[model samples]
Target: MTESSLSISVLLVCRDSAETSLITEVMRKFGISVRHSVETEALELVKYQKFEAAVVDFNVPLASMILDQLHGSASNKTAVTFAILNGKSGRASSLKVRASFVLHRPLSPSLMYRTLQAAYGMILHERRRYFRCPIVVPVTLQKGAESEKTSAHSVNISQNGLAVSTPVPLGPGTSVAAQFKLPQLPPTIAAEAAVRWYRDGKAGLLFLSLDPSLRSELSEWLSRRMEAFLRPVQ
Candidate 1:
């Protein structure tokens, strides 16, 4: 993979200045942007921002708690996580924390680069799911056989759900059948979705029953869109 051509955002939680500098430098080389945070503030940041990956230092007092928060967060649960261990002794504990990768202490640039390369694919896959593409498309929503169909326009779309603006917003917990077409996807994507939230004439629909093939198509479409924006015109 051409690591430098990809765009990835990571949450770096390490209080050690020396280690932080080394990690930051290595990540930059791979075209990944790091948002540095201490263990205390990292928990809150994970709740709000969407990151493809996170690197936490196990030596931090609240490191485990921060990892818990990251995995528990709805927005960040799937984020690829890396645990920085001071020595081999922390390996077993790091496994329990479920970090996607582990970096041992006395981290060298070569070691960091290798680990990042190993996790790069997973990071991109997670990043693709978090990416929201803005496109207005006509969408038909039907709650049930007896209910009237609602016509709405999509505000934005992600791998798991869609945000749509409607004349009347559907209430949360409402189940609906959605049918819409993406730019290059030949067939109309139809899936059963649940209304996750509603506000100000808009509702968020979580796709609960999308077919695997359709999901693959949607993922590919979104990846293309992301690459288009990130890559310069040729």
Candidate 2:
């Protein structure tokens, strides 16, 4: 996807309206959509919705608990989180809460902008892991030396793995070499992949070893496909 199309969803848990306004303004400039929640309803929202990042105000009675729940939630365990503090002393304390970063009281637009800029790359990287692009592509899988290769067609592709359907019986944890060329890409991509799951002639393969260059190429291809497919029906 183009840089302009890049966006992140954030859960804002600040009780202070003025503070939330400042935070949202800065986040909006960076293409981030914030879901603001008051302390009373924050916990329920945290349990269900998935967010790329969360900004919490520590003054609220439930703020620390919200951060704890975010880390404990299976879907949000790796989400980036920020703690809003009223003093510098709270900075050290926020670390114990496992916050990814800390923002001192009296937020400024420039500081917020800079902070988001620094975090954009990491947030995008995390999002890519879960972005799946559906496409059919011929894939060749080999178990080991001297073994015959199996031909398969991929059902979907993600940054770390691909799901494919083949007649060969593949058990979980079976290591195999995978080779395929993405659409519109001239070079073929090859990687060592291990079977993550299999059922009824279909299997999920987690890439074990992919060259950095080829991985980048595949990621770009998937991003472009996803962007085009998800475009609004204008």
Candidate 3:
């Protein structure tokens, strides 16, 4: 799948009204279309609908209930799941339930976006590895000088940077420009990146000029891609 081809569905459950608004606002700013549902509805929806990932507020009263539903036998168990930890609970306990990632309270939009991107990227990377695709996408280090375009393929992607395949590998300190096309969105949205590494068609590119809105759009695109990929191939 190409970068533009990505789409994601996120389930946001929060007991605190302020937190909910903050999350929704960030997602909206990024142009991530979301489905707002109560905890009960969200859990049931997970059984049938395909969501790229889910964001749950572990601070809510129903947090444990939601967790059980996510880990329950009825769950499809494919979508990536994230929990917002208030720091009262131990990470060890959360890890046991298979929460892919956790975020602490007093959240920032940037942090939330980055965490989600990382979790999703990790999930996709594992899937691709399991399928053994000859081409792997990189998930980190996607920014550098604009003059020189380096050849690379993404091993995985996040809002910040992407892992790429590099030719004429350089060392860790080396720098260059990175360019690649995302799948569905316009090629005009191509990422201008900075090279973070150089090694055998594999390197990192940090996005040079992505803002909150662009990040949201990218998130939405990834969510959609996840749904499409998880769908039964017809």
Candidate 4:
């Protein structure tokens, strides 16, 4: 679906019927429509539905199997998957799943809402970048005496640079340093860059000095992030 036409479909799997109701209520408060299901049968149903996202129980029996199936089915479609694990036994298992985010059980409604919004924003940003050229990265600018730190979330990236989301506003011609950790990659790279433009909490940075290896690493991470958006539906 186009980014502008996108709508969120949340699959909420819970063992307790009462908890399912509470989860559904929270989703509605955020204006998100959700599909409530028992853990046992939710996996099969999810395979056939075109949900934009899923929220599942981490401790449910066959949870791994369900996650595996979902992973296989995700194609060219970015669906944010979240696992809710309350008990100690489920912690390790939840970590093993390839979910975008995981939450401990005894769910906090506010936290859940915020997490959902962030995930959705990430997915939306990815989709927009894939379809349009010159993806804008969101970045926060923190000025220092000698240099400025441009903290950015590399939401979308290309060979030129990346789109980043930051915590602070920046202006044109601002020289800054950017630091971010790539998913599944070690050793964060700090680069000298200059802000070409700025908007609210988002800014575009032109890397001043970056080695070939660092650029290649950033390209690989960008590819993986883009691939997540282009994954097909199973």
Candidate 5:
């Protein structure tokens, strides 16, 4: 995405009424957008939606529920979460659960800013590696080490990769050759791509090598998509 379009939006799940507003203000002061609500509403949001990153007060009543629902077991994980460690019962045990980062009480502005900065950095890095924009295209996928071909549908295309839902998932880091046609283009786009990630039947493919001509075509396609993204909607 373009610099103007890129933003860091985090889910805030703190219960301290004063600190909740204060935290939101702090995020805005750092130029990071924050989405927050009452503890009840926030819990509901985390249950069904994923955020770029989530900052949560692990001391709240619904904290564990949020974690279990959003960052659960391996097959159910969604978003990276940062929890504030409050010294309460079961706090130490909760440490066993997965969290991007955890901090103790008595927060400072600089510390908070830096923490979120880290979270944003992590999010951006993940995006660069596997982030995708919406697109639909048919792809003929062939594993680099295998001769079998699999039919797949590209759901979103990104700078480094594309997300595809196929009948079978290509193992992560497996090199592959792909042939596909993007919308609004004249020629077929083909590249040596590597499977960067996979879950269920969907996988992310990172283009490892793009010849000059194909690179030029892909760049043009990306530029067009970015322009459309920047265009104001009616």
Candidate 6:
């Protein structure tokens, strides 16, 4: 549960055996393992087990039922679910298929790969945000035409960014030098960051130019946080 990977269990739902078989095999080639389950029982599986994604045929009547069952359920809440619809039917059901991405049938392999990649990232990003740690750390932000520097405290930290509590919040697009150190990391990490959004005294900074070394360090730190976050509370 702590370590993450591109590898994820997928729920494959479709009426046609050939389409499901082709898609499942293609997913395996991309290093994504999947489990094809009947729609009748898949909802219960989705509710009780962890599935990172689901590929469904939008044309099937059961597809909507699967979506309805898993939409807010814990197992599928953050799972990346996408549908395959006929090109002509894409528009009609665009509003109906509750998927993270919708690809037309007669699917392009390249496009599907890229779509799944994006969906995987989105799923992981949401998971991190949900498990963000509430740890305050020293933060120094430098910004503006005057190169003004300010002291702040990180309110919460995730792999992507940290929300900062500063005396003065900068504009949304202001670029800055962000410096901080987490307990899991040794040296102070500095990165070129930008204010993503600001409200009142808090601003969220997205690290922009993190070097590979620093990114590796940060990734390790985040992995540790993930482990701690997923530990069952006794």
Q: What's the candidate order when arranged by decreasing lDDT?
A: 1, 2, 6, 5, 4, 3
How many clashes does the backbone of model 4 have? 16
List residue ranges in candidate 1 displaced over 4 A.
Answer: 1-8, 47-50, 71-78, 87-98, 142-151, 208-213, 226-234
Candidate 6 residues lying further than 4 Å off, grouped into runs, are 1-6, 126-234
Q: What TM-score would you give candidate 2 relative to the actual structure?
A: 0.64
**Candidate 3: regions farther than 4 A off:** 1-6, 29-31, 72-75, 88-93, 122-234
Alpha carbon lDDT at 70, candidate 4: 68
- CA error at residue 187 for candidate 6, angstroms: 12
| Backbone-clash count (model 5) | 0
Highest-TM-score candidate = 1
Q: TM-score for each prediction?
A: 0.73, 0.64, 0.45, 0.46, 0.51, 0.52
Tens-place lDDT per residue, model 6, 71-133, is: 778646877788888888586878767778888877766766677666766655545544446
Lowest lDDT sum, 10 consecutive residues, model 3, at 126-135
Off by over 4 Å in 4: 1-6, 74-77, 87-90, 123-234
lDDT of 5 by residue, 1-234 (tens): 443234445688887877677677766654445777657887677665545667778777777777776665332264667787754654676667567887666777777777766675565443333334577789999885458888999978877778888897678888989888887788887889999899999998888987788777776677566445433223
Residue 43 CA displacement from its true place in model 2, Å:
4.9
lDDT of 2 by residue, 78-104 (tens): 998888887777766766766888888
The true-structure Cα RMSD of candidate 3 reads 14.8
CA lDDT for candidate 3: 0.58
Model 3 C-alpha lDDT per residue in residues 27-49, reported as the tens digit of each score: 65443445667777876776665
